[model samples]
Target: MSSSASTTSTRTARPVHTTPIQQPPSDSTSRIPVTPAVLRSIFASSRTPHEERSISRIAFFRFAGFLLSCVGISLAASRGRGIKTGAALLGVV
Candidate 1:
């Protein structure tokens, strides 16, 4: 009985402090938007290198070009003499 009575129970936990804390780099970069308005905003963002220009910018440029072409063609056609110009002027053709 003498040897068994001398011992006392104790508890221990596993070491949990080995992980080092790390801080992320500062947020100094501009973010890109992912919306329909992004197409419009992109032009105002920067004068980028030609090779790095985005596809959305190309699409917007193409659409503007197409609209201008239509306007020019309509103007030219509207100037035709007599029947053709009359049809255009009346908004019937």
Candidate 2:
């Protein structure tokens, strides 16, 4: 009886206490951090000139193809627009 009661007390025991987190007091006099300038400097350090443009070209073309697919699907879904498919088939020949 005593062993079972002790086992149940151990299972239900409250956790050991721990110290609370400590931090510096807030200071209104501290200069507000400038995020944009820091971020700009970080990006500026990694920048390359024409290589960015070349990447932009590839991304633009990939996006253009994605846009064209939506247009093709829209055209195919319209009965009158289905004529574009016949035009495409003709172009292949």
- Candidate 1 lDDT at 64 equals 100
**Residue 74 of model 2: what lDDT?**
79
lDDT values, one for every candidate: 0.73, 0.74
lDDT of 1 by residue, 3-82 (tens): 65667878898778888877655664654546877865675466556634666588889999999999999878766666
Whose TM-score is greatest here? Answer: 2
Candidate 2, pairs of clashing residues: none
At residue 48, what lDDT does model 2 achieve? Answer: 87
Q: Which stretches of candidate 1 lie over 4 Å from their true place?
A: 1-53, 82-93
The 10-residue segment of model 2 with minimum total lDDT is: 1-10
